[model samples]
Target: MSFITDIQQRFKKGTIVEKLIYVNLGVFILTFLFNTFGFLINYNGNFITDWFILPATFEGFITKPWTIVTYGFIHTQFLHILFNLIALYFVGNLFIQYFTQRQLLSFYFLGTLFGGLIFLLSYNYFPAFTDELDRSYLLGASAGISAIFVGIATYAPNYQFKLPLIGYVKLWHLAAIWVLLDFIQIPGNNSGGHLAHIGGALFGFLYVNQASNKKINFFDRILELFKVKRKPLRTVHKSKSRKTKPTSKSTKADYQKKVDVILEKISKSGYDTLSSEEKAFLFKQGKK
Candidate 1:
């Protein structure tokens, strides 16, 4: 088979997470090849040093609006891309087993978006980064990947991973340790990057909860706008058609029953009397 065809087959046969890893690696390899021996010409007249996500520079931000998205695709160092691709291949693949491709995609892009937001916020607002000389450029996909990692951990807290020395460890434990390390290291290392990591994690957690509730799927809404809406039936209520009785108990009935009990408890005792689990259940039912 042709080389290109073989790669295409591998991509098609791979899992969603695997496909993403492959795509990222492929881009990295192509970038390196195109810049082979420093013989490659700069297409946009920008030096490698100038090519990065610089939120403070209006010109940089406007001219390369796509940089917010493309920054994650570019890694200057070989190991920078190497570790990211490896982490994504393993953590991301495990995440997909529980989440749909749509969810994973949302987590990734939205995480990246929030990461940029935090980067801008920190650069513009923080005292350390406010100085012109101190302002720094951002690169790498670590922020977004951190989000995906923590997200999967949160959703399935009990999910276990075995380490070489450590026995099976719960996902939440791993997530907590990761967060702690980031928080502790923030003051010493790249504070902006750590801040971005937190932003991405928040997006990931919110995205998962939002998906569970069915309140809104951003992609679904985007697709809906382009979809042609059909007209309602003109024969509606022509003869007042007999109401069809539900064959089984309606979900609404079950939901109402739970609500009624909660209300009774609240009325007899007080709002504070409700346990956390009960409160969460009622809140979720209210959304329905």
Candidate 2:
């Protein structure tokens, strides 16, 4: 097939995460064109302004409540989107292996919401910026990206990723480094944005942990509510069992044995007594 056909096929079969990246890229291009040439032709696009997060005091929320969500889609510059898209490209596929498209989208937007809330609250409430600036703004996908990172890392803490020069690193270590960096930098740097990062990371961690326990599962219910209904239903007659069948394969004994061991380990030395491999296997089994 030709290159264009190949690209078309990929798009047709691409996951929702990939499609969202495409949409963000398309919007960025439109904004760039409008800002550059369209302005000279009488079409000025403060396009980012339309989606940029504004303080609660500015009445922006009244006029553009949608900005709370849309701002995550808007990037300030080429490099800003470039780095984020690259991170998504690598991490997004890894996340899709276990999470549904809806769940992934939820994490993204929810992360953004948490991030924006922190930014607004800090700027308004803290003594840092409230006295100097009447209003402040934030625009980027970093918070959402950070959330994705934390989510995937939380899910599979021992999963290793190899870099060209640095060799392989465990996911949990990476998460720790990121979280620590954000914590250390919050005091002097963009306090609002850093606080937002912490908020996103917290959400990511809680999302994975809570999901394991079945405590958080809005996606399934939402999908069921919107699912299409069939026009008609067919009834089937029940058939009697032909005979008692003997099972060739059995897992009850094996499953119980493993469960007992895990329970014993938890009871004796606490849950952290389990090894990383043991924990990962248990987590995988729990999902199943």
Best by TM-score: 2
Candidate 1 lDDT over 29-91, as tens digits, reads 766665663565535433433554544555567776766655666676788888888888777
lDDT of 1 at 71: 62
Q: Write the per-residue lDDT of candidate 2 for residues 31-98, one digit (tens) a residue.
A: 67657775787765565664555544446665776776677787758988998888877667666644
Best by lDDT: 2
List the global CA lDDT of all models: 0.65, 0.67
The TM-score, computed over Cα atoms with residue i paired to residue i, of candidate 1 is 0.68
Stretches > 4 Å off in candidate 2: 1-9, 41-45, 51-58, 131-135, 187-189, 213-288
Local distance difference test, candidate 1: 0.65
Displacement of residue 96 (Cα, Å) in model 2 is 1.6
Candidate 1 vs. truth: CA RMSD?
11.3
Q: Each candidate's root-mean-square deviation in Å? A: 11.3, 9.1
Candidate 1 positional error at 5, Å: 2.0
lDDT of model 1 at position 44? 42
Candidate 1 lDDT at 59 equals 52
